[model samples]
Target: MKAEEMWKASTGKGVKVAVVDTGVNPDTPSLKGQVLTDEVPKEVSYKATEDYDGHGTSMAELIAGTGADGTLRGLAPDAKIVPYRVALTGLDKAEMQKAPHLAKVIRAIADSDVKIINMSFGGKIDLPDVREAMKYAHDKGKLMFAGTGNDAMETEFTGFPAAYPYVVGVAASDESGVVGEFSQHGNYVDLAAPGLDVPTWCDKTFRSYCTGEGTSMASAIASASAALVWSAHPDWTANQVLASLIDTAGRDWARDDPSTYLGYGLIRPRKVLENKDFNPGPADTDPLAKENFRGVVDESGKPVAASPSPSTEPSKGTETSDGDDQGDRASATASETDTSGNTTLWVALGAAAAALVIGGGAFAVIRSRRGA
Candidate 1:
């Protein structure tokens, strides 16, 4: 489905998406007017308009960009992007050696007013504090999605954030709908999308665009699709929105035979949106209530940590509250620092302006970009 059609109903105007990553740049043309920072908390040192690393900017563009300069286009063009600059890359070896600040940033996003949270970063270890924070967001009625990691050629290991219960784990697929060989496969994968030949920012400078091949872009797309639905039905609870997506996901296989690599299949929000009378299932039913489901009840009926594999680092600092801050992961942030190799684009962005509005209506569109 084209994004232009969805804009007719709603452009995600009232919906806010919180991106938690290195940072975002507010100058991008595609992201000019789509970002909102007023709701972000002040405690966080990051700005919602700056993007230090190009990774977050690219992800942002994929979710809500305006398609300026003939660059990447987003699914929810009118949605607002809230940036959060978490320390994922190392300032030095010591900074790199420290545990990622994902936990802090995620907790902050949940605490804020944003309804959608996108996290495109992952590592082998599962930070305990981060898991708790994710659960907190789920309880708060926030929709969260994360990358399933890209370590297939290496150790073929599993990673956290994606593996956490309540967090929608996304996988990478090629233009032909085939799962990429590099995309890690596991029971945690919840969905798949075009990630092999996606376009994005190459650096914080916003100089040029590049072709990206990973699950990060897929996660961003999934999150944006959610934004489209949430924006249309502002009264729907987070549980209802998520349940609708799960119920309408496209798959040729049996409902019980969820692919370890592809999860429920590619998301088709159109299926959910087309049927105005469609039911979103039970609001209390966890969309992931089957095997590999999260928020599981113990034999004693108490909520237990469902993490089969936990992060190596010890939990530190009490995250007393659940609120969102100005840290957008897949999109632009207020300016900051990034040392990762250039692989994204930076541009001058306006505030919430969208040129095209795709819809849940199926159309023969969705221009694929290759080798930017």
Candidate 2:
């Protein structure tokens, strides 16, 4: 992804990303001054800074961690993080009850100044309230990203929020730009990012960083990729930012005919950040209008209302590369539901590396060479 060169162009300054997950620990060495805890809405701020599972903190760091003292460096290191703690799986029953409702949390972030929303969790069930909240956030012009899921080899269930209209469903990929075998595939998959073999927090203990793999990291990296573009082009609207990403994404198939596994292929923000003369088309036009409208259905299998007309002249000059073949697109409904459970964080922990304490045990750090 030419991250070092991309950083030379834009370090994601002046951008704030909202990480909706288990929770985030702001005291981590790399996140010392990168988190804006006070900016989180009080109504949904329960334990926002207290990471019960270390998953949310890892997502935050993936987006904006400073990489201080050899800690994991984020794709957009200069960006700020606004943390929101909601009850995802792995939390105890008591903490789950105390955590804010996912719908309420989404609504609150929709009303905030955050530019992007990164949801690194997924659930088999689809909640109506959360769907409405996603629509609200879309209407408010907030860019949102969620994991397509990591259960492709199993049930291959369509994850909620990711399947919801207006939310960009991201899939996990590797350094070769090949979609991870575990990444769930469907029409909802909008983009792919490096998710396999990434470094992340081991657990709530924050004792050491471990090799992690999942769509959760992909979503965070996708969010950071947007931050880099948004920071470089601060005036671009959410639609414009999204359009730029779609336009510049690496792909083998035609833009209109997306792949089930890789969607628009791997995210390449450096393509946008490095181009000063790039035109992001119309700010009010949605890049994913076709998928947001035609690809989704109602509870009774009726097609949803169509979005406004897309840009008559879509952005030209997309970067293409070798990728998997295209497949049939699927439709989702706002009223879809399952009796399963709440959203689950998508990270799968791997072996921990030797830990190194920085600054008198302020936090422990671990190193990895894998690209996010």
RMSD of each: 9.8, 10.6
TM-score of 1: 0.79
**TM-score quality measure for candidate 2:** 0.81
lDDT, candidate 1, equals 0.63
TM-score of every candidate relative to the true structure: 0.79, 0.81
Q: Write the per-residue lDDT of candidate 1 for residues 251-361, one digit (tens) a residue.
A: 656665666667777666766666777788777777775534346778888766565332222211111112111112321111121111111112223333334332222
CA lDDT scores, all candidates in order: 0.63, 0.71
Off by over 4 Å in 2: 295-372
Candidate 2 lDDT at 261 equals 71
lDDT, candidate 2, 214-240, per-residue tens: 777788888988999999999999999
Model 1: how far residue 90 lies from native, Å: 5.3
